[model samples]
Target: MEKKQRMSRRSEQMGDQIEERIVTGVYPPGMRLDETELASGFGVSRTPVREALIQLASAGLVEIRPRRGAIVAEIGQHRLYEMFEVMAELEAMCGRLAARRITESEQRALVAAHQACEAARDANDPDAYYQRNERFHHLIYAASHNVFLEEQAAALHRRLRPYRRLQLRVRDRMGTSFSEHAGIVEAILAQDGELAATRIRTHVVVQGQRFADLIASLPMLGSPSLT
Candidate 1:
């Protein structure tokens, strides 16, 4: 079990590095990732590197071809918008359910998570805020007290993590995201399901605008690697 956990952590770290490169356009679209090269660069064995690529493929960040190895996934504009749309609805549902079903303990946990996000935001750390942002949403999903719903939310959240992380790179996005969290938390705490739903839906969907800012700021948008 310990060995498995270690391997899992290593794979996750490798995936994070590769995902960062892709998001920042260092790797760009259609950049074929050689497992051996990545392993050597990261000072790891190919085993973990291969595992990481597989994980990335599942997250929609990479595509694995029979003879081509792994390359970044070329997600189209329409598909990207569709994904954000679904993500908004999922988050809104979580918030709505959490507002009506959250226990006192869960509420406290949510507050703590929000506070952590605030700390991360105030420190001007996008990476830290991203981590806390995850915790904040996870707490709400847990508050929903529906195992299936939480699982669904988690799966999609994992798939969208890279895109969401990129949006945080937009100018002053962390501050705005933090402010949005304030409204979301307030609505949930007040047991206003309708308000929570609306606030969270808007908050998630706002990433679309952030994506636009990111594209505009960058020299060029990366192309998708079609398998």
Candidate 2:
């Protein structure tokens, strides 16, 4: 059991390293991940590397083929737009519901999450801000007090995490995200459901555009050719 637990931890760490590279453009979309090379690079046996690749595949970040091994999954422009549209509407619904039903405690948690994001921004750490930003949105989802809605929103949020993180690389995006968060918090605090819904939708939809711009600007992808 102990040995198995250690192997699990190693695989998780290896998976995180690979996922970080994919998210940060180190391993851009459509790049093939060679298992033998990964094993050597990670200084581990092939087993852990294979396990990590499988985990990444399940997250939709990597695709596994019988002959081709694992390659990073590409988010085409049309599919990207569709996902963002759905994400925007889902978040808008959460915001509207949260505004109508948030308890005082939940409201405080939302404020704390926003403050955490602000701290990350002040520190000039986009990675940290991204982590806090998810917490902020999740808090709002929970505040909605709708189990089904929260589950759906959380699942979609996880799927979109990588692209969303990439958006933070856009110039001054962290600052802009924080400003948008301020508006969202204000509307929610005031119990203005419509305004909250609108603000959240705009915030999410704008992120979709920022993500597109980031992809287009990447020297590696070279003109956002959707695969």
Best by TM-score: 1
lDDT of 1 by residue, 78-134 (tens): 566667788889889999999999999998988899999999988988999999999
Model 2: residues >4 Å from true position, as ranges? Answer: 1-13, 23-25, 45-48, 207-212, 217-227
| Count of backbone collisions within predicted model 1 | 1
lDDT of 2 by residue, 1-227 (tens): 99999999999889878988887679988899999999999899999999999988977789998899999887666666677789999999999999999999998989999999999999999889998999999999998889999999988887777677778878898999999999999999999999999999999974445766865644333223564
Score residue 161 of candidate 2 by CA lDDT: 76
| lDDT for residue 216 in candidate 2, whole number 0-100 | 63
What's each prediction's clash count? 1, 0
Q: Candidate 2: RMSD over Cα atoms? A: 2.9
